[model samples]
Structures are given as structure tokens and as C-alpha cells.
Target: MTVDDSLSRGIGPVAMTVLPQAAADDDERAAAHWSGQLATFGLLEAAERHFRPAAEEGDLTAVKCLVWLARQDGREREAHSWLERAAGAGDAWAMYELGVSLPRPEGLEEAQRWFRRAAEAGHALAMNDLAALLARAGRREEAKDWYLRAAEAGVTTAMNNLAIQHVLGGDRAEAGRWFERAARAGHVDAMANLGRLRLEAGEEREAASWLGAAARAGHQGAAGLLAELPGAAEAAGEAGLP
Candidate 1:
């Protein structure tokens, strides 16, 4: 509710650094690909270098990248132009990004429309976002359905969120199953939550195991909780949880 779950997929740009040489070839599509790589690394200036050429050449991804960069620079008007350009061209990522970028108060309805457009286009991230919004609006059944669709489409965050919904519904076993599914996929939050659940159930050993893995994975909350367990540090090290 606070912000779009950019990290899950779609318009979420990854923080990266390396600029691939393969993406720098004479091909426009290749250049666009490189621009995305650069943008993912938070190398906006470098990303923009490639974005201009690719977007000018009509590369959809490059257009989306330009939108992302403009937003990062606080150029909302510029970003909107790029968003409109890409969306008009049927770029689902652009539609999804535009939805995420909309200003609140007047944004929710418009964002929902954009999300439906993108989701109908087979955008998994858009589906998940729409599901969250539906959930927030207290439409549990519809939210559950969308979450299932997204989770089945391999959105790990959807798996975690679905588990949360299960908890709210008092379906403890279902929650545990989904949490484990997400944790096994390397979801730190799911791992931590599962650890907490096990601890609450008096399954300290299982709790320590999950907490150890989440902690080694650099989840600070998991680490803090693990530290309070008897011999947890030594046990985690001995178990080679990392």
C-alpha cells in the first residue's frame, strides 16, 4: 500500500553495475537491452546514453527505461511523456509503470485501469499489484484469486502475500505451506515469518533452522531473532546454513 512492489517484477528496475559488451553492438534491440542492464544497476547516466538511441529507434524497452530514469530524476512530466509514448505503442511494462507512477487521490482509479490493461496482456507483476489493491479494498475472494494466478505464474512475492492472507483467514496450515513454498524459493521475508511461526508453535529447532538461513541471507530481523536463541550462532555455523 505504501508503494508499488517494484522488486517483484515488471517495471521494477534492478540495482546493477556491469554494462555488458554484447548489448553495445550495432543492433538497436541489443542497445535497448544494454540500456536496461545499465538502468538495473542504478547507472542512470550510463543508462541514458543507450536509452536515447534505442528509444529514438523505437525500442519499447528503451522507452520504458527512459521513463524510469526520468522518474528517478524527479522529472514527472518527462516520465509521463515517455510513459504515454510506450503505452500507446502497447508496451505492457509501460502501462504497469504508468500505473505505479500515478499520483495518489486521483491515481488509484486510473492505476487500476492501467493495471487491468497490463494484466489482461499477461503481465504477472500487474496481476499481483492489482491483487494487492483488491485485498486492501477488502475484496478477499477476488484478491485470493489474483494472488493465486500471480503465484502460479511464479511471482514469489505473491506466494508470501498469499500466505499472509491465509493467516488472516485463520488457515494456519495453508499459511505454513505457502510460507515454506516462498522460503524455499529464497524469499527472506517468508523464511523469517516461517521461523516466527515455528517458534510460536514451540518448534524451536525448526525455528532456528529457518532463522539461521534467513539470517545468513542477510535478513537483519532474522539475524536479531536468531541471536536470541540458545547457541543459535554456533548452531547456525555448524549446520552450514549459508
Candidate 2:
């Protein structure tokens, strides 16, 4: 559909800055952009109207968005079909999504296969997930390797997970460094974790700072821990903590 057709259908005018003029003129890119915005606003019918045509034309991003829309509409089978079509075309994101969507235990092997493929294609999140699967299967060394790869690729969760691996390996120094890195990147769990580590090392002020940061980020556990620190509640209230 044309841009005017999209606007006429009550999708409203999208900000030009959000979508470049060149992309607006490209049918596939326009469809993907409009479908994503529609999907975000729960306009599933309108999103599908834009997405299906692009997906049929082999736009991997559109196929991925269609999969999400299908799942949101409780059409699991349709989502899987779209995922498979995109994954078959070697789309890294589609492979990762397909891996995560598969039923656990029964589909574990298939999920790992797809995760591995996606990871090999340089999908950072896939590397993190593959590490988790390997860790579950008692492959600690391989899991650590994958986690390191993902962490280096700037996945904050991978950095957190890798820190946990270091802790398990009794390398507290390395673990603390990783936790600090992830926390600086705004990973709430890592903030809580680093706070706990600091508390254990008798660095109460540092611990409270990290814990307060995590608490303000809506981490219930961090909030609870922060409440246990002396004078923390008053400090939090003074800082307008919500």
C-alpha cells in the first residue's frame, strides 16, 4: 500500500524523522515501519494488512513482525509457519525467535539447533541463549565461551550471565568486573548483583549506591535489599525514589 493509503486508513501521520524519506518511498520498508507502529498500538488488523504482503514478498523483517502479530492474536501455528519461512531464508532473528518459541524439553534439540545456527550467523542474543542451553546440559566450558562471545558483542544480559559463570568458577575479581560493566550498561540484575558483592566486601556505601540505582529501576529485590541498609530508606526518600 502507498503512504497516502496508510494515512487514509487511520494510521495517522508518522513523524518523518522516525522514518527517513527514502524509506517512506520504499514499499517494503514503509510496510515494515507502518506495520511495526500499528502492532505497537495494538492495531493488529492494520498491521497484518501491511505485513502480510511484505512477508509474502520475502521481507524477513516483515515476516518477523507478522510472527509477533500472529502470536499476539493467539495464532501460534501461524506464527510458527511465518518463523519457519523466515528462518528457512537464513534470517538470524527469525532463527532466534523460532528457537525461543519451541516448546521446551520436547523441542529442546530443535531449539538448540536453531540457536546454534543463529549464533553462528552472529546474532548476539542467540549466543546468550545458546550458552544458557549448553549450561543446562552440563556443558560449562562451552557455555562460558558462548557467554563471553555474547558479552563482548554488547549483550548486557550476557555480561551478567558471564559474571555468574565467573562466580561459579571462583573468580570473584573477574565476576565483579563483569557485574560492574553490565551494571554501568543499565542492567538492573547486574546492579543488584554488584551491590550484593560490594556489601559482602564491607563496602556499604558503594553497595547502597548500586542497590539504590537498581531499586529506582524497579527491581523489587534491590528495593528490598536497599531497605535493609542503615539510613537507606531516608536517603531514598530524600532522593525522591519511587
Q: Which candidate is the best by TM-score?
A: 2
Worst 10 residues of 1 by lDDT: 16-25
Candidate 1 C-alpha error for residue 200, in Å: 2.3
TM-score of each: 0.69, 0.75
Cα lDDT tens digits for candidate 1, 21-67: 23222233543554455455456664566568878888776666676
Candidate 2 residue lDDT tens string, 54-91: 78998776677677667667788998998899889988
lDDT against true structure, model 1: 0.75
lDDT of 1 at 23: 25
C-alpha lDDT values of all predictions: 0.75, 0.80
Q: Ten-residue segment with the worst summed lDDT in candidate 2?
A: 15-24
Error of 2 at 153 (Å): 1.6
| Model 1, position 98: C-alpha lDDT score | 80
